[model samples]
Target: MSKIDIRTVNVVQYVCPLREGGSLPAIVKADDGFLYVLKFRGAGQGKKALIAEFIGGEIARAIGLKVPELVFMNLDDSFSKTEPDEEIQDLLKFSVGLNLGLHFLSSAITYDPLVSNVDAMTASKVVILDSLISNIDRTAKNTNLLNWNNELWVIDNGASFYFHHNWKTWENHLTRTFPLIKDHVLLQKATSLEKASEDIKQTLTANKITEIVSNIPEDWLISEADSMSPTDMRNAYIEFINAKLSMIDLLVKEAEDAR
Candidate 1:
């Protein structure tokens, strides 16, 4: 695996929780003097969610989409000491280690399909990306997309790559059609899918796939443990992604038919 250069920061303060979703992610200030949206490791989905967030962010960026900078957040016990809510306190306790943070896009608004207009190429890329990762969260009801600085920035990909949730069934997912693509907020707007598919496959080289999965923190890898070691887990992701990569044509066909 090639060396990946990702930022690491110590979370200095828990600003407030974003209660819009059940997972309860929080806004936080870090030692670097930047505010971030921190995704806790102890959330119901566990560290595999953070792994998905990290890898998904890179994948989106690689496909020419804007994703907020992702950083590894170090959370100690002190950050949770003053919390008033027991639920949050428990969340802090379980997340007392490396969490994931996205550089907060101040004043960003949710991407409402009713109002926002995305060009076909950009929309196509996002559709292909969500399909490739099997992201079920980008539906019209809860589009995990934001409009920041007049640009479409993808966020909250923790729900993608769900194959990791059950090791026994992971292999079965690689070639399957992403049925959820039809529900994607941008699916009907994605007119350039064939071009987008070629571009995505061009960008996702084997080395790039390895690099993305290889960057998963060992902590996240261990959280998925029933029997596989972290190294084994990493290899499994490489295999999974490669299989998906090899069958991009199938995924594009699904996306095209869904619209």
Candidate 2:
């Protein structure tokens, strides 16, 4: 297992906007050190984004993948000269000089997405895992998976809320379905679906799921977010994660019991 150490770095020169919602810089550290630049935002964005990153990353790490060390760091707003999109600029103006907490993922030194370091079987397993987790971030366009030195690493989990939308009333988003698991490579690696399923089930347990959502900073929740209390919102999210976890558990447990 890789260890992560968190520290502050002066990233003034490396700041750049990302193609996505935030901006960060590619930073270099002293020999044996690694770095990444994260955009700073006000407390208003709610901490849901960060929470998603935390949970996704934690789970990824548990499942035998390399996840970069993540930290919440304040940035000097003046460091990045490239003006943010007009809307982001206005939003920041109101907060005035507040440092946005940036999430730094150490660069994967030997990873390349365009090339496959793992077999196609492993890739299939990864896709199934992402699909079951409802991670909307890792589509073909983003392809956050990388192969470095014969190992695969997953990154950039900022878009993990596919199941958080209000589903109580059968909203349109309910159309989304968990991906088929039968042909997946990673899912098959399980001694039986039972082990993998139990792993996911434990992750989505009521308390664990609730903790993940509740831990989200108030700023990351959307403005005019659902009227539910944080606890209620958290409970709702628990149900969402449970839906998938339960399925995995059932699949794996029954298989294990049968054998």
Candidate 3:
């Protein structure tokens, strides 16, 4: 696996709150002069969401999907003072450290299946990846896709890897069937799941998975009290993903049946 470098930037300005979900990610201007959609570590869902964003987005990019470049944004308390909203101010005050940032796509439009035509290959790959991660949030109501520069970009993968919330049961849940693909926005339009499965198997090698999960910061993993060390948590993620990869064929069949 090649070296995966995630750049770290300083937040220069607090633009506005996205207010899309409970996490309340915001749009901010960074020192690098690029606007980013920042996900706060202090949000209700906490660091696990950031973990999913890093791992899932990297995997999507590895498997020939276009994902927004992810970066680490350093936040300070001074930026929190500028925010007018009390709730957002509180969020910023608590998130006074490393947070996840998604490169903001200027003039990007949300993907709508009715108006946007997606090729079967891209749709199939998205469906297969979502199923493998057991993402339950990419339904038609919330596609979590953006149409930018005449291409589709997958985003907001914080909702993937649902089983991670309960570490004790994670091993038992690794091989459980992911039935959420039935509600996936691209399900009906996707074809060639077998080909997508093969491509994913080739692209996401063990080394690649290791590199992806290792990108997560140690602090985030240790934020909550747990017996596992940061390295152990990273290895656990890799193990869970490998187990999921072993069942890709079953997942593909499930998606095919749903379609």
Candidate 4:
């Protein structure tokens, strides 16, 4: 896979807050004249959520999923002063540095699985990707998918890699099966989990995994309790992914049985 170069843009204007979740991500216009769904680094989840978004979105794109372009957005303190809402102002003030931004789809519609038709191959690939990354957010209740220009786009991957939140027990769960796959929105429509796993395994090479993990900003991987350095954290992520890839067959079986 080719290297993904994430652009850095300044936030020119604060449009509005997307009050859907607790993280307080907002829709902001950037200096590039493109609107972005900006995830604040100072939000409740902190930088780890941004790390997950970067890694998960890039991995999804590598395996032929349609994901919006990601960029590093610089938030200036002055921009927060214009906000009318006190809560939003506080969020903007706290996130004064680099934040994760997803290129916004202006007219995209939220994906409704009941009304939408996703083919078997695409569904299988999505399931495989989620399982590999241990994303527990893509349930039927909240697919985290968007429909735009007749294409399905994956979004909101910050909820992935839950194990990273507790690095102390990360090793124990590294080889564990993802039981959450049973509730995956695409599971019923998915077929051929083995083929999907093979396709992802072929695309997500070790170097590509390292590159994706390395893309995360050094400050985002802040060490806690002297557990590991930022570089070690990146290596740990690569190690976990590689270990998961080695056990693709087991994950595939788990998903298949769930379906």
Per-residue error at 32 for model 4, in Å?
0.8
Against the reference, the lDDT scores of all candidates come to: 0.88, 0.48, 0.89, 0.89
In model 4, where do residues sit more than 4 Å from their true spots? 223-226
RMSD of each: 1.7, 6.6, 1.1, 1.2
Which regions of candidate 2 fall more than 4 Å away from where they truly are? 1-14, 19-34, 37-48, 76-114, 119-125, 165-176, 179-195, 198-211, 249-259
Q: Name the lDDT value of residue 95 in candidate 1.
A: 95
* lDDT comparison, 1 vs 2, better candidate: 1
True-structure RMSD for candidate 1: 1.7
TM-score for each model: 0.96, 0.61, 0.97, 0.97
Query: How does model 3 score by TM-score?
Result: 0.97
Worst 10 residues of 3 by lDDT: 223-232
Cα lDDT tens digits, model 3, 139-203, are 87988999999999999999988777877777887778888789999998888788888989999
- Per-residue C-alpha lDDT of model 1 across residues 136-214, encoded as one tens digit per residue: 8998999999998888999999899898888878788877878888899999899999999888877878888888887
Number of the candidate with higher lDDT, 1 or 3: 3
lDDT of 3 at 136: 87
Worst 10 residues of 4 by lDDT: 223-232
Model 3's alpha-carbon lDDT is 0.89
